[model samples]
Target: MVISTHKMVDCTSPVDAARLFNAFCIDNHNFMPKALPDFIKSVDVLHGESGTVGSIKQINYPEGRPYKYAKNRVDEIDVDKFYCKFTAEGDVILGNIEYAVYESTFEPLESGTHYTMVVHYHTKGDYVVKEDQVAVSKEHMKNMFDIASEYLVTNPQLYALKQ
Candidate 1:
């Protein structure tokens, strides 16, 4: 299923948008309270380069109480337009997922900036044929976007330049 979420940030630059995403990814105490042990080993382009396309991030997941070791790959980075596409192929809730793209566009609004995050994904494996389950997936996506927007807006220090 494809889920498109629209939101506006009270800012005038893409740097602020990227800062929010980066802060959310790295700042565990605030953003990732549910997954405390989760640590990001490295976040860089896949092929030893940096740019918009082919940007990849390697996340390391050690064995936990009920969680198993896993790795996620995030590619298709677009710094100029402020977007990136991610595809995970491993022991994830949804297997064989493809085209899991997340694109964020920031435009200068009259008083602030408009930010939109679009996510396109589809389920795989045995659950793929269960067409009726699409609602559940869409709901999850909606919840994710809501949480993200809330975080970005509520935490002004993220893009405030000064701590």
Candidate 2:
């Protein structure tokens, strides 16, 4: 079975939201480790090119985490739409989910932007996923987005373009 979860956040600038996502996709290695050192040790580009579609990321965690590291692939990216999709691979299972896809889209608002994030969960066969189980996974993903959003909102220079 498949399950999808979505959440949105309102921001003051579409550039901040879109660039925050671009940072998440590309500079996560630089920022995530700094922002979430307690949980993430480092994010290394294992294959392909950094920030490009089809690139693979190896996310490492500090000792004693459930999984030592998780691998994910960049599945889709639309600069025009300010959208991105990431597919979780080996050792990256969230709750009972066997496959997870995270898609983020930045929708422009009159004042700023509406950031919508969706996570599609594919379960391991033969059984059903309970409501609580899905909620747990969804909350986990939402918290992640919140953390990123807060970072961008608080530190606009992180996503600022270089001259």
Candidate 3:
């Protein structure tokens, strides 16, 4: 088995950290499909409660996409600190990859939110992850963040932080 790790720390969103965190890590099941209907079909909780640790979710993609669905299990989450960690498997990691672990952190900033993402890819047997695969994954992650940020910016009251 081979493991590859990638980290991206310079991403920033115009939305506030709490709101972005709510949309991405906590309420993604409701927010993602609504924000990007053509890309994401739906997110269903398969086990445990949504937004909680140990919960597993199945993210379904729209037709014509490369993959149909992917299952992700929430390994850790901290609402107060705006941190979350999850592991993705199933169709998303088919072929040479065993699974991929993702960790995200949203830090509040004066202008917006500073976002960071780390991904750990575990490959099957002696297979090594290619640069193109990592590039594609990073692009997908950035697109998701951009889409969600735009949606939240347009609808400010959607995921507003509570007092």
Candidate 4:
């Protein structure tokens, strides 16, 4: 087996950390599909309660996408700190990967939030994950974050109550 880790940092958002975290991490299951209908079909809890540690969620993608669905298990969550860690597997791994662990954080700044994500990919056998593959994954995540940020900016009251 081979393990590869990639870190993406300094992604800035003009939104508050709490609000952005609330929408992106805490309420993503409810908000993602609504924000990006063409990309995400739905997110359903398969085990445990939603938003809690040890919970498993199945994220379904729309038809014609490269992946059909992915299952993620929440490993850690700290609402106060706007941090979350989860392990993803299933179709999203594309067979070559056993699973991927993702850690994300949204830190408050003077004018916005500083976002970061670290992904640890465990590949099957001796297969090594390439940089370009990681780049594509990072780009997809960035696009999603940008869209979510734009949605929050447009509807300022959307996740304000969650904070």
- Local distance difference test values of all predictions, in order: 0.43, 0.71, 0.88, 0.88
What tens-digit string does per-residue lDDT give for candidate 2 at 42-144? 9998999877899998999888877788888889987777788998866757566787778877776665567666666677665455556656656655576
- Model 1: per-residue Cα lDDT over 39-125, one tens digit each: 322233334333324434444444452333233344655555545445544343344453344454554445444555454455444
TM-score of each: 0.48, 0.79, 0.94, 0.94
Please identify model 1 stretches exceeding 4 Å from their true place.
Answer: 1-70, 93-131, 161-163
- What does the lDDT come to for candidate 4? 0.88
Query: What is candidate 4's lDDT per residue for 74-102, written digit by digit as tens?
Result: 99999999999999998878868899999
- The window of 10 residues in a row where model 1 has the poorest summed lDDT is 2-11
Clashing pairs in 3: none
Against the true structure, what is every candidate's RMSD? 7.0, 3.0, 1.4, 1.5
Ranking by TM-score: 3, 4, 2, 1
**How many steric overlaps are in each model, in order?**
2, 0, 0, 0
Candidate 3 Cα errors over 4 Å, as ranges: none
| Candidate 2 residue runs with Cα over 4 Å from true position | 1-15, 94-96
lDDT of 2: 0.71
> Clash number for model 2?
0
